[model samples]
Target: MDDLLAQFVIEAAELTQQAAEDLLALDCEPGNRARLDSAFRAIHTLKGSVGLFDLAPMQGALHSAEDLLDLAIKDNVELDPTRIDPILAVLEWIDRCVQHLQRVGTLPPTAEDEGAKLVLWLASGRAVTPAPSPVAGGTLPQWAAKLFDANPAIHRNGAVALRYTPAPECFFSGDDPISLMAGVPELVFARISTRENWRDPAEFDPFRSNLIFEAISMAKRADIEAIFRLIPDQIAIAHDATTDPSELPAESHETTTRTIRVDLARIDDIVGLVGELLTAKNGMSALVTQAQLLDGGLALSRNVAALQQDIGRLVAQLQRAATDVRMVPLGDTLRRLSRLVREISGQTGKPLQLVVTGGEIEADKTIVDGLYEPLLHIIRNAVDHGIEPEEQRQIAGKPAKGTISVSARQVGHRIELAVGDDGRGIELGHIRSTALARGLISAEAAAALGESDCLELLFAPGFSTSETVSDLSGRGVGMDAVRSSVRRLGGKVTISSAVGTGTTIVLSLPTSFAMSRVILVTVAGEQYGVPMESIAETVRIPASAITQVRSNEAFALRDRTIPILRLGDIVGSGAPGRSEEMLLVLEIGASALGLVVDGIGERFETLLRPPAGLLRAVRGILGTTVLGDGRIIMVLDLEALLA
Candidate 1:
């Protein structure tokens, strides 16, 4: 990606997101001039930027979209809810094309045809076309039936249908029939077929040009004719054209300093360097220890320690600045998702209102970027499965329009995002039955489970209460996928539902993955770190306090029996028994576990580098970090270790 193309990709994505958002808003408040203007500007700016590259298809499609919006703004055409479909479709198409351009260095081969359809639709004022006749009549030709069947969206309002049959030897005369049809103005749809009767495979010729081209365009007859001027004697055109039926408060703004855009990769590099500096700072502890053994040790060590403290303060400041630089508000993700919500609502024919709050909460860029897909799957399921139909809702004493709320908040060093829907909540009985039918659990187990346990079944792989599959969801992938995605980012997902009320899925994740707070512990003289967040508390009990429970050792803490495990044994480094037991009480979800260690060390915050080399395959190791004594220790992924 050259600098120009890279810049184009970024700008194109931003512009498309903005345009889609504005268009969605315009769809609801068709009378809002502000949103209308913003959408038009976004499309216009996008069109101009697209012209800089060899993306005529995208450029033309965007141009047509711009014209349509311009008509709405000038009151030449009413911007109804349905009329915005073509513009939205065009934006989505452009976004897809832009992604392909960024990844493959060129537009897709079908771009021209797709763009033409969008252009024609826009030209027709995006009218809702009637269903094609069941039988071919005098007005509808047999060829058009096939064309309409293949491209159902081809607008018939004021549409010109053209059929072209080039001479058999036309291919040898430097003529391209497909390219000619692509050049037709306002071309909506086209089809290619063999001009003559079928021939056997053994007798087929390699090249003879026995093909016919049929297309539907919104352009006038003369414009369509000009496209095939050289082969006028070989084409027929028909006209079936008909007349087509075609936000908020201002917040006070204070002047702020100008800002410059910086590439994310550069910031990541700075963060990496900062982590190295932290490691170097930790290495100084060894120097301080060594200096204590010198002749004037006491005084020398004190001075060096003082210097180390000063560097530590500066390092802390640097870490704060770097982390802040990586922080991005959740609003960006939510705004992008707003488009998906609207699209789902339209497709399902279930009116929906998206309510979002606490978008100002910021988190690491990695978390924000990875959050999109999981949230997408959840929202799709919410609409397709959770939300009921209009009649059902009305009968259930609920509003005709469903509401999906996405809210974010900061709790301690973590961020919690909740996606809730006011719809038909998950039925625990249904989940139990599905689990049994799928052979995920035995009838006895399902019968013994409680509400909370039954709810957990929703996250099980291939678990779904939906009886039928739709494009949006079903086949049991949605919730399971959400759980997997959230877990990959070191997050926890939980679901809560009330019969006849609604359902809410909450995701709890760390604010940043670059740094972590862990309590150092030693197992068989090998130092390790456990995330402090997972530790409920540290406890020391007499060896006699442990009791054997069936096949596992257990301990009593706060009147609750918690399983106790030797960390050394779990890590394959068993240690000898001691008079007293040292334990780190870990709270994972609703279960408590006591992890036995040799000794407890200091609690420290440090940059955590992901496991690499041989440690990458280690299941219980979350990452690795440098200790103050200059030794590298593995950080335990308590969840994975315990599981």
Candidate 2:
């Protein structure tokens, strides 16, 4: 294997991965032009690159895939969920092949054999066969032999030279450029350069596209033709060895583009700068407060204050920019699920249609990556447990084909993603019985819990409602993994189900690790801080309006009475003033109570950092907040309060 062949193999695998992902999106977004184009291009890219390697099997498979995808893109063939599984199977095969090559210096098993089957499957109904290779025998530059082959020569502007630029992602084919250059014809002079300039040697990858080329008598035309042949925009051949000689028409060459890869360490540098700006903004604020307290205020101090204000604005902008660095579109992980749905539906003989909404939603890159498995689990569960059988659905007055809808929405400082399905909902009694049998709950407790509560118990590990397990989903369970994933992100998951109606699972996660939230209330004759998310609502009651209920003081709210909890008692904050204290109705889960305080207050927002060690173990309070008035208020954690 030569360098170009090695590069081709690596690039082909990547293209297959991309094509599989694109195929998955087609079912969710019917007639999606971008996905269609992407799938076609990925296949074309792989087919073109694989020509350099002697892997005829992989090449044939990619050719078939490219032809099929092209047909769909051009509206020649219908794009349906049925068409995606074979593509995924092929992609998975290619993935395995690459893994084997990584472990051993040879292509895994018979990749071409599997690839050939996939190609034939895609092209079965098409009247036209796949296009013939532009090049054969090797990835020779255009002038050498077949059109697609690398190291092939080209003719451009009447000048010819052997030309080939290894893929930015190459070297997986098990080839070395040093030895590859030695094999090419008319070897005159050779030059090498990677896609990026090396600022640090340690960051450089020796095989990751350090493009090498040797040209001689190298008809300047041959080089130009080779460059123009492999890629229309990437190469050029001129009268002299001048970089980027205007060999092609300026109109077309000007449109050429380049991509750069930056290490994550560089991004962290920007985030660090943002942190410093925040710290500086805080320091300036502290300094200004001291200046105001000084006995004599200098005139120059006022100018310095104005400068500080400008810096404060600059810092705010910097902070927003830094945070934006973490935001990435969610389309990434969700794109390949269509393939999974198609394959599983085939195996189970169930018609599954995946509907996606708000795929354009963007969030922290880390969050998007974390969402893949959770999202997959929900989709799978919906198919297995949420959706009813065809006959059962017809009896329930539903369409024969069940619909599974996945949606993502931005809510406050959080993103809420939901997966819903039209199916026979959870059988509440079965869950209660299962819990009892598992020793997870006593008979009395099971009897006491509501139907919804019993359904929620399915999130426990090793719980499964499916009878006579199937390979698709009845292998123990997966919802527990879903809950665990969301929880690890400091998020929560909730499920709602109605028998013979439908089911919905919602995952709520913060946009970032920590953020600002404040709820204003009075305590100890002064205003205090509480997170707004912690407060369910507030009730105003006059001193004489309150009445006793069940031997305890309670307040009537919308015809429902709630227990009262005095803030002074909970925090030992001196005592409520003689005047009637305002009752703030706090709610979490099934628990709702009122906090009696000195007076009502205005709400505000501020970032709250979790305290260290055991302090974080305190359940009721989330974090402390500093108000505009410089008062420290404790932000209550309503989730903790209820749990």
Query: What lDDT is obtained when candidate 2 is compared to the true structure?
Result: 0.62
Best by TM-score: 1
Q: Each model's C-alpha lDDT? A: 0.79, 0.62
State TM-scores per candidate: 0.59, 0.50
For model 1, state the Cα shift of residue 236 in Å: 60
Best prediction by lDDT: 1
List candidate 1 segments past 4 Å from native: 1-261, 293-295, 433-450, 460-462, 467-470, 475-480, 573-580, 612-618
lDDT tens readout by residue for model 2, 337-456: 777788767876678788877767778666788988787778778888778777777888988888888888989878888889988877789888888887878999999988656766
The C-alpha RMSD in Å for every predicted model, in order, reads 24.5, 17.3
Worst ten-residue run, lDDT, model 2? Answer: 131-140
Worst 10 residues of 1 by lDDT: 247-256
